[model samples]
Target: MIYITGDTHGPKSIGFNSVDGVLHRFNSNNFPEQKNMTKNDYVIILGDFGCIWNVDNESSSEKNVLDWLDDKSFTTLFIDGNHENFDRLYNYPEKQWHNGKVHEIRNSVLHLMRGYVFNIDNKNIFAFGGASSHDIKDGILHPKNDLKLIKRWKHDYTKQFRILNYTYWELELPTKYEMDRGINSLKCNDFDVDFILSHSPSSSTIDILGNNNYKHDILTDYLENIKNTTKYKYWFCGHMHINKKISDKEIILYEQIIRIN
Candidate 1:
């Protein structure tokens, strides 16, 4: 079976599992619905796995999440969300897995690269993961001088308080190269895919959902192009944090976990 779910920010126990000795949540759940799945089954996370954060100093929470995922019966696959630490994630060696390129975080956990096609269970799957973080406006201010008070202030106090760039926000949108790569890959396969997986929904889907606050970004534009040109049965996304079908083909996921195959 192939299962899919929304964001899980570093496996911090969304729910408990007594069967697994109090270590189940999200894809690692010990619920009856997932009890039948074995190691052969796969669970793909849309984005925001968050296991790679603070790689310089591994926290207990991060370690616990990694250990739990490593012991899981099913393989966990994820894409790069806006909250991920790009430096750490990119350092991992990229290799081929399940007919696609992925960053092997562990033997059981994998990070799916942006703009790639994979052959899973004889189904051609197109995967793209990235989105503009809406919370960039809340980022910390960068200190203009060596003054400690200026640097430590939490609010906009003076003219020197420029919003710190690259602290909380990340460049999570897809690059032009990644966009072209995905398009070319689809062209090679005659633009046919069984499914499309992404972190953010296309602009058209967002419009249909009536979400006007989302910033117009290049990634969303690229996804809109894909929606117009690509041939796929379903497109699943996660960044919206809502459980609803934006259209007949596009679905937004949040807390609910669903089976795709």
Candidate 2:
């Protein structure tokens, strides 16, 4: 079996809320648990890997998270979240904090801003890391689980931002790579993305949920239009922190499948 989960923010130190410290509800232990598994199982983490960019610390959190899903020792896939720093997403440090304990100072995951494709068990899946370049003006933690937060984050027009530079990080795929890799295939008239998991949902999927009085972002409209006309199977995203489904002529938005092979 395969398991997919999201939005876990944890710190490593034995501070308050630590495994032996305070009692917490959303600690690293929240990762999915399974039994009767095999080496073929898979696990997908949508985004929001942690609260800060502490790579060494984050590794500990990840270790604990992985422990919960250890029944079959599934293969793991990670999507970079806005809260995560790109530096640690690609290059893990080679230092050790203690004997036999390694401090991983980087995140080992595919970080695609525009999008990417993956081949798994003879099935192809596409994804886009929708990490926002803007600051988290709304604070990292929210008390409300209401969809209102989702809507606010989606339509927070005031926070509109773009990629300016990323010279310090190797974790993310270059912007050029993200833009250049797909046009040809999308325009090929035959190739269609199987699954697209992005950190930020395209404005078409997210904005369309809003009242139609507002104008759409031109690029968003263009991409969605192309995907619809091109014929893709599905789109999965995490930025809004809301699980939703949108049906279009080209794709089924946010549908879950147990197996694709």
Candidate 3:
């Protein structure tokens, strides 16, 4: 079995400081209760691995996130998100913890992109990633509002799978720029995703964070049109920090599944 979740700003962010505690809660309550969990289980953390990759100093809260999952044997998979400093995450110096486990290890041996696929529990899942392009001026990716990241993908040909957008600037910058690529990927390449996991909610599952009136309506119409024509399964997203259900095929929280017919 595979578990999917995203939009954790990290342990040090001022507004989203309790993320570690929430991860612990989810791990303790949700991980143990699952009947399908096993040594072979894979956990897919969509993005936002850390709030700021520049903080070389370790915070106890960040350590707590590692400590909470120390004993887990599952193969954890991670991809980069916009909030995360991509270069820092990819090149951060490694250290050892008192427990003898390597600290601050980035699990991304693979680069995240639009058509990559991984097999978990006998099922094939594909991931497409897009974070705001790194700002050379400010050296930060999140809190950036320039509807200009739309040109990242040159082509989109995902074989029926899931869409996980890990960009944190969703509300302030709904990545309206990314929409054309997303829709074009689906339409031009004849690709259809069974599920989508975006860090910020788009078009209504639960986007109360931004109250994104403009993009949500656009996304809604697009997704609805796709659902009407195809046998698409579900669209699962997080970032609103609230659990919401938009329809039979869309959910606005973490850990939801859709069985393709």
Best by lDDT: 1
The better-scoring model by TM-score among 1 and 3 is 1
List runs of model 2 lying over 4 Å from the truth.
Answer: 11-33, 55-72, 93-115, 133-174, 182-189, 211-226, 248-261
Ranking by lDDT: 1, 3, 2
Which lDDT values do the candidates have, in the order given? Answer: 0.74, 0.44, 0.44
Model 3: residue 169 alpha-carbon error in angstroms:
9.5
lDDT by residue for model 2 (108-136), tens? 22233234345544445554443443343
What's the CA RMSD for each of the models? 4.5, 10.5, 12.2
Candidates in order, TM-scores: namely: 0.85, 0.56, 0.52
lDDT tens digits, residue span 36-114, model 3: 4554665655555553344454457755665555445554444445465444454554443211122145442222333
Give candidate 1 regions above 4 Å deviation.
13-24, 27-30, 55-57, 138-169
Candidate 3: TM-score? Answer: 0.52
> Any runs in candidate 3 off by more than 4 Å, and if so which?
11-23, 26-30, 34-36, 56-64, 67-70, 79-81, 90-117, 129-190, 203-231, 254-261
Candidate 1, residues 27-105: lDDT per residue as tens digits? 4333456567667788888887767777455578777777777787777788877767776777787999776789988
Best by TM-score: 1
